[model samples]
Target chain A: MDKNINVLIVDDYRTMLRIIRNLLKQLDFNNVDEATDGQEALAKLRAGNFGLVISDWNMAPMTGLDLLKEVRADARLKNLPFIMITAESKTENVVAAKQAGVSNYIVKPFNAETLKEKIEKVMVHA
Target chain B: MPDGAQAGPDEDRIEAAVRAVLVSMSGDLTAKEAALLAELEALGRTIARAKAEIAQLSVDDITGAHIPSATDELDAIVDHTAQATNEILDACETLEKLEAEVPPAAAEALQGAVTRIYEACSFQDITGQRISKVVSALKAIESRVEAAVANASGRPAPAPAAAAPVAPKTEGQELANGPQLPGGGTSQEEIDRLLASFD
Candidate 1:
């Protein structure tokens, strides 16, 4: 619920990035940044003082799940709150994301309230 | 196919029979086809298994190979843009409301921000055209795949699922819509229950 906490939003689709950024603004999240994919997201996360990562599940070069795995593997980023955004809520996908240590997940086309709730859940034990 | 829908099965059968006979008597055969008709019938039977496997695949799968699920992605893109258009409009309204409450300078800034947000909605035209392009590409593949299917099945290929007369899409279709509107995907409760069951 800390509006000041820096968030890194990553998606290959510009529209999705804009949509999520706008949604985050509605949620009163001012400290937000974006990247086009996991590779760039990882680089930004490494360079910045981000407290959370909200990423789309699919992308080229590297996927959000790959970013989650890499984040979990990196000693410095292992505990950062990661909220995965998936285009499908398949059982296997949920299990895979959960197993990879995602803090929470939001199905795409989410609204501000959903973002708020998911961020709250992740923040509780982030 | 729409033009030839009235063509009877007998006509098709006779034509196919003639074509099969001609192909059978052809002097030139590919190395693989020649091997299939070797001294024993086992080779032909062995090749039949592979052909059967391919034949069993759904028409969509055959056509899908040429385009990697672009149809679905394009559909999603179209749907997302429509929804995002409304979402952005709502955002603009919200910013406009905020403008009234803020200081004059901040209000002007808010108005400017709203302009930028509205401009971003221009993604609609480009995205719509992109979706159209995807549809066109899919249509081309559909034509080719249908011909292949016709050759394989020895009948006119039926119209693709997309081109089929519009009907009430099934709940199965709704479920298949990946991360669509709210409640389109598996609920968080399901994931939680799954995790709890594991414990």
Candidate 2:
């Protein structure tokens, strides 16, 4: 299930997106696509089938939290696993994400190991 | 023991009356004292409570009114300070850009001047060439006339001249020579017309 998962990576920074994509590839998740923001991500998600979503919290147009809420509300995408990557560590933000039905949360500046651990955790529960 | 024990109804009545009177007066005094002391304690407590309530109310009022004003003043000061700092930063940036822009513009102007001077020097070269050609032609014509004169006289023609000589002349010689026209020169208008054709 881990190796065959279709992952969608969303981030505004090109460098960060490449790094995350590389990390996911290293973890043997070969099927990966990228989007720059929430709106593009959602468009891609609707256009294609994706098993998981990894996204940055802060972005223009639509934020990651908003995307998470939208994904959860959608009948088709409600069961999809969504992991939030962010620099913000406020308790209320985390609580709100949990309430919004986020699969998991990972703080930013994370390495490949942290990404793997988070993905594995989400996948196991999912 | 008998003396001490000797007592009757009148004596008993007198003793009972005295005991009753003492008990009554003592009970009245104690009750009055207790009531007064209780009242004093309650009044003291009430006054202390009222003082405490007044102090709390004053504190609440002052904090509620004064704290917001202080906060607002502080916020305004901060905002003004930030705005001033931004303005200064903007001015500094503009100055830096101006400083950077100035030298290049000056350099460009200098370059343009040098280019113009080069063009003028080139034009001068062309004029000099034209003048030299005219002078050579004039010398040729002069030599031809000298030959014709000698030939008609039937004397041996003077030694056939070589190409026109280009020797450095003294200032006195140059003045005496007048302006040696290049081959007795073409008109200025013809030169101007030639230059205009190039243009």
Candidate 3:
């Protein structure tokens, strides 16, 4: 696995972005960019060829679910690995994300190891 | 046989009975209406009080409740604290990277300080999650208040149920719920099992 793979982290909280960035850094992933919401993430995704997307499920104007659906619709980004991190740990949410072609799901309050493991699980298998 | 006199009294009796029945019916209707108005007034007052609390959570220039923007403030506090913590950790990481160049005693002390800072930063995550709980509660209250106001006013509140988070108004996720407090929400293992069950 290339630890330097470019990963896009989308979240409304700047703190969460920083935390994810720092944790990625710990795991030797230094190449990361960010978006504050799904709309911004879409703009970024179209502009760059991201190896993976780590996004929050809930956001304004556009949501991670919206982003996932859009990504799946786009020919260029349809195959991109997407992981959703959210406090919405319900079965329906998981099912919805899966139906939208999400690669993985991480519940909130997760540690770096959990995140890393989830990411690697998808990245390796995908 | 005094038919004229007898008919007059019978007519009067019938007229009086009809009047009495109408008056009683009117009184009953008025009482019901008054009770309904009182209940509505009480509900309206309760909703107004809740609206005030929602305003305290976050309000616009007009003092109208804007729960999302209001909770955003609490979320921002957590964000800022976490960002500062990240900066501290960045410094710690830098120091650790240069640990070989520093004296053993100095390195140990610096490492200890970094450890403490890192641990302290963990508080930011918990704090942010806790704030999420407060926001969720506010949203629930906001929704109920909105529903009451809408019911009373005969107008739909702007996505009243949207006070709960994670999903939007249109086609809200049937199962998605808001952030959980400590000891709340589904565990990762449960999520994993649920996801696997689909397979």
TM-score top scorer: 3
DockQ of 3: 0.30
DockQ head-to-head 1 vs 3, winner: 1
Model 3: per-residue Cα lDDT over A3-64, one tens digit each: 77789999876767776776776677889999999999999999997899999887767778
Model 1 achieves a DockQ score of: 0.32
Residue-level lDDT of model 2, residues A1-126, one tens digit each, is 557878998876554565566557546798999998888999888888899999876665666777887888888999899988654344445556667777777654444556777788778877
Q: Per-residue lDDT of A1-126 in model 1, one digit per residue for the tens?
A: 678999999977666676677667756797889999889999998898899999977665677887888999999999999998756577777777788888887764444556778888888887
Off by over 4 Å in 1: B1-185, B195-199
Worst 10 residues of 2 chain B by lDDT: B171-180
What are the candidates' individual DockQ scores? 0.32, 0.01, 0.30
Write one digit per residue (lDDT tens) for candidate 2, span B1-199: 1221222334335445544544464434577776755554454444444433333333323334544455555556545544554454344334434444568777556434433332222222223333444555555655554444343333455586576986664221221211223444323234324323443
Regions of candidate 2 where Cα sits further than 4 Å from its true position: B1-199
Task: Give the DockQ-based CAPRI class for model 2.
Answer: incorrect
**Per-prediction TM-score, chain A only?**
0.95, 0.95, 0.97
Report the error of model 2 at residue B140, Å: 86
Superposed Cα RMSD, model 1: 13.5
Clashing pairs in 3: none
Clashes of 1: 1
